[model samples]
Target: MGTNQVEMCPVARLIFVVYLLVTTCSASPPNFVLLFADDLGFGDLGCYGHPTSITPNLDRLAADGLRFTDFYCTSPVCSPSRASLLTGRYQTRSGVYPGVFYPGSRGGLPLNETTIAEVLKPLGYATAAMGKWHLGLGQNGMYLPTRQGFDHFLGVPYSHDMGPCQNLTCFPPDIKCFGHCDQDVVTIPLMYDDIIKQQPVDFLDLERAYSDFATDFITMSAKKKQPFFLYYPSHHTHYPQFAGPGAAGWSRRGPFGDSLLEFDSTVGNLLSTLENTGVLNNTLILFTADNGPELMRMSRGGNAGLLKCGKGTTYEGGMREPAIAYWPGIITPGVTHELASTLDILPTFAKLAGAKLPMVQLDGVDMTDILVNQGPSKREAMMFYPTDPSVRYGMFALRLGKYKAHFYTRGAGHSETTPDHDCHIISILTPHDPPLLFDLESDPSENYPLSLQGRPDLQALLQKIQAVREKFEATMEFGESQIDKGIDPNLEPCCTPQCTPKPSCCQCD
Candidate 1:
């Protein structure tokens, strides 16, 4: 049998054994709450060292959970990043490149593919997804949340700023585009079984609003002692900023900071809910963002600090994000510098729940040890590809231990200024360049590239990138099998902005 076919060692098994051995007690699967923020950058939170940002709630989360110093989202953009998260696989493998799904776009998550929700639903867990579900939209393809296993979903089908605005600026003084942008003000219109029960959720009051819903959910489930998965996705900090109720005049950082306040309060609310429900000690809470901040417009985002590149680039800023996991009685409060990816969540959750994952090809390994056991890091390298440009889609990135290699094709009009440097068009309309190598450990900022003259090892790593690229090309050229095998037949065709209809849909059975 191939290595891919081998059953991965269950990290949950070790957790269960340890629990029984230490406490002399069997364990019950804890309720899972995934608090996902939209386009939240690495330095946006107070824990990550944002000087002016006040995220007391999230800071508290770090104080109580395992704070990950080197964590990355699978994709750098919103939709594809989210797709990778939902399926626990690289978006590229699933043909979910970058770019938001516009109205009438036929693509969504492939129906046949299993999602985190799908994997958990069968175990008697009520799975719900709230806030930005930007996977895809429309009929005749697989983008709707229902097809992907989310029992309840709310918020915009795509980014609040995806479509054209009333005016050039994302913020509204103009009512025409603003009204369209706020279409979801009345419950982002129901598709499938999911519906936004409430409409016009105040952005500033989001933490309270969503928390109320999630708290109710937890309380209801707790009353019945039922295990449930509540996926809380936030729309704050994305664009078209709305300040939280108490945060209206709070920050000097403008609307961006206001959004951050809402996010902080949201986490605080969840934590409070867990504590009040008597599940704080048992419930496992994972907090992370879809991708790095949007820095092209400084008025909208904060710096990735020393990290090179900001949203929409292959640089660390685009993919690297703030991540922390907490289960008061389970995870020790401290920092882990090991590299971890959002993709690992699926397998990790399965292992923790004592559930066997269905036969499926997953690009992510379960990082249960990193979470529970004080074991060495399991993820040595990660492959990154941003299929979307406007948001994030690095052509290719591979992290081998501390050394990371990035291979990107600079297409036309790539120039965009950022806080640290003047981003300009490079290698435009040309063949890809030699890979850029960086020692992430020595230089977390990725400011200096290792000189090739003294580095044969670096050259070998670049060669590895070339080899990986060749294989990827072969898969695309030969029309490899699609990733999602069980997509709803009624779901639409998921594709990128410059997508060409392939002979077969991007489905993998």
Candidate 2:
């Protein structure tokens, strides 16, 4: 027999066994833990090169995983970005084309859509949401975390600052006083299911509150043999920075730095918990922020450098975020200059868990390979829309490769009736307009833009961005007629008679 034929003997069985081992090694399911920081900037983390900032835990986490340098949030603000994340679709598709929603806001993830929890739940994964829930709080028996997909929900229904507040203090009036403001500031305790547990005596240092809840969720899930998903969206370093007692000493950088220190400690605590639980090796931890920092706090906040514009505007700072993916055994550590987005999380997690998605349109792409293999991002284009005219100040932007095009109009009232006025004057909005193209390979800060006057490559990039903008607009279901009628009245206010707060919209006892 030839040598090739001779391999069919018992010795060949040894080779087959080795092949099986290798294949099995490649097919393991990973536990996913997403740590979403609220309104943290691109330069907030130490790994991102923030000077004098203390984010050791995050820095170490970045070292352990692949840090994505060009990651973008689907939207610049919290509610819209989160809506995109949970649905893996643009928030506009779900009617969240606006600001953060409240119990009475007529907006939320549509019932037809499937959340990561809903997708993974059927596949034997224990899913839980442990922090902020900015999606609508359905008008009575219609919308709630448990109804959405999460088996457990513990934390604020919206932004931590959303609850009844006086002078920006998050304290809700005391229930004992029948909603009277007798006591100083009534500490708004966190809500678990329907009960208010410990009142957060002072948000000036509420970082520990978020961390403690996340730790509890981790420990609880670790005890179960099944894979688990923890969506820990922290209320930290957003605004009105509350520096915890442990970080009170760092008040020199103002409340902002104090909040930063507290955030670092919280991340460190979670990592330590994973280590102690012995599941650190198998868990996939994702760290990112909702959007850029509040620009008004620049003196108190970090910088985004030449990327242009800050929060409340459709600039890089408003949309770009610091992202790190750490799964010790699965992902190799390095800097990935890929263009990724927050919307990819839902589908990515679903693919990892072998979960089936309900038939529906999704905007996020499955980037599991990019996460595992590493290198240049597979995504070629990214688009953003400030649906809410108020928050974004009437702007829309799209980025294709290196070229970014944005249109800005003055808010509310202005007419082209006068010679100096034009009906929605469409000038190149940004200082770096006329579609300035940056060779990101050479310019990381985006300070220098190569002249596009003679550059066909840049022109093509601009055209590509325009195409993306068109596609985005075509996909959007705008106008009052497209609104869902079944959504709770509180979520979608109605002028029809006999409309009271819907049952599902009210907090349950």
Best by lDDT: 1
Candidate 1: tens digits of C-alpha lDDT, residues 360-442: 66767788777766555666567766544222233466786787776653321211465344233453422235666789989
Per-residue lDDT for 327-419 in model 2, tens only? 775666677766789888887887666677658887777787676644345566777666363232323656666555554422111111212
* Model 1 CA lDDT for position 489: 29
Each prediction's TM-score against the native?
A: 0.80, 0.77
Model 2 — TM-score against the truth?
0.77
The residue-level lDDT of candidate 1 at 68 comes to: 85
Off by over 4 Å in 1: 1-16, 20-27, 140-142, 163-207, 388-395, 409-415, 419-422, 425-434, 460-509
What TM-score does prediction 1 earn? 0.80
